[model samples]
Target: MYYGGYYGGVGGTWFLILMPALLLAMYAQLKVTSSFNKYLRVQSGSGYTGSEVARIILDRNGLHDVRIEQVGGNLTDHYDPRSKVIRLSRNVYNGHSVAAVSVAAHEVGHAIQHDEGYFPLILRNNIAPIASIGSRFVWILILLGLVISPFLIEVGILLYVAVVLFQVITLPVEFNASKRALYQLENGIVYRDELDSSKEVLNAAALTYVAATLVALGQLLRLLSIFGRRRD
Candidate 1:
């Protein structure tokens, strides 16, 4: 009878387990931001701006048509497949810091993947909307089921699976981006000195994805445990 409460599930353990990862993610994010800002002030000795790095990288990958444009903000860089544009945040686009070059080059990696039609990247783009919808329903369905019939719980379980699938798919896409960024850095397309710093920043960034996946996995497990306890 006491276990009837949905909170009786793996909620506590799930949170506890993910607590450290969440803390680490926060720390990593802060470190990256601090480092980026710090490097932002250190002018690049090579005189190559973010757009210049992006241009050369895209040209190398035969994505010469992908326009690299500067948008306002910090760390707001991304590659838009729809517009065929690589949008670089103001600081990254115009600055000649290690942060600028690294962030800019990383976005170009996505463009390269698009040009070559990478499978994981393709899968991620396709499933993103479905996953977004599923996430919107997951919490409500799951919590509602906990307070009502077990059937709602089952529905929530199915929905959470969709979210997890997206998380799994994202791992490859992100890792590949970092790998490509590193490759570009090593090839002299971007420059050294910033190599270690870029690597550190990217490494921190990657942990965010890992944290997200782990959170999803925890939720999936929580749903499974709820179902299991219902049976028992």
Candidate 2:
């Protein structure tokens, strides 16, 4: 029997490779929630709402033309480079808490990245659309390849690699953004005590990206193992 026959089998090599990634991803998600909740309760000494903090950072950086808008949903804050706008979630837009301020500043970090033509930021943006479309078709192609043609399996692997690459690029973008946020906050936006709390929130958020990258890597390894067996 071709080793491809064992594809998706339970308690095999696949299980060993995937277990750690799954665990890390779960832990990262929990930590992000915990840190966000904890810091959300702590108000900033600067008493600036998240929107105000974002506006201040943008203006100080000569981004006065950039617009700040309130967005709905939890933790949906983002900087839309195409729109040249920063969209803060409802809580962050009006709340004067450490969590709110840190998140607000982080989005502005992306805006800064765009203004400066950050390499990884630009690469990630270009890769995002391919990864998005590839994600939906990977499993289908893999399953079909298992029964039809090994060439399809190879295509699936290539697509999965692209996704992993996107995740890899995302890590630096997020970390740099978080670092920028902390540095900006430490300058004058928050008191000494509040600085640590903001760090905690950003650090937890960073872990999520780490976990995502790990998961993507693990999945790619799993696919290679399964498909390699068929070739052998």
Candidate 3:
């Protein structure tokens, strides 16, 4: 059997290794969406549009050169460190809800990270291009390794390790960004309940990163196990 050749005696163990991570990823995604939706409906007392909040945060940090622009999509906000631009989704660009502001602030947190040369952020950026290439071809390399050469499997495992490291580094960068967002929000933009709501939103969003890391770790474990079995 092809499975016998590739996976050895642990033919079906991929399911055992990956199912928990897959489920966690799904739950994290659902929680982020639910949290965002809940806060999106709750109007903030500040009555400031998301772009306005971004401007406030950036200006307060002496990031006057950074520009905020509207982007089309849901929960697609990001800071382009290369271009020195912050792009917010339409709901965030125009809406004055806690979710909108919190998300915008979280993105601006990335701008702050860039400006301050945050270590993990810098490391993640340095690894991104290689990780991107690894992500695209790692599976193919693994398949070839399984079919052709045990040495190729080792090579694939090393490449996959790089991808996993990138994800691991990303977790801190994301969580720190959320932390910066909440810190800024607490400086009088939102009151007690509103601050709590923003926290919930940012926390939920951060889980998505956690989920990605877990998924990568699980996949790496599975690959290692399969390789071990193949060697045996």
Q: Return the top candidate by TM-score.
A: 2
Cα error of candidate 3 at position 106, Å: 0.4
Q: Model 1: per-residue lDDT, tens digit, 64-85?
A: 6899888977777889888899
The lDDT for every candidate, in the order shown, is: 0.80, 0.88, 0.88
Residues 117-207 of candidate 2 have per-residue lDDT tens digits of: 9999999999998898678899999999999988898999898888999999999999999998888888888888888888889999999
lDDT of 2 at 226: 63
Worst 10 residues of 3 by lDDT: 2-11
Give residue 213's lDDT in candidate 3 (0 to 100).
Answer: 87
Name the better of 2 and 3 by TM-score: 2
Model 1 segments more than 4 A misplaced: 1-13, 226-232
- Tens digits of per-residue lDDT for model 3 on 1-232? 5544665534456556578778989999999999999989999999998999999999999999999999998998999888999999999999999999999999999999999999999999998888887788877888887888878878888888889999999999999999999988888777777888998999998888888887888788778767776676
**Model 2 TM-score, 2 decimals:** 0.92
Question: Candidate 2 at 60: error in angstroms?
Answer: 0.4
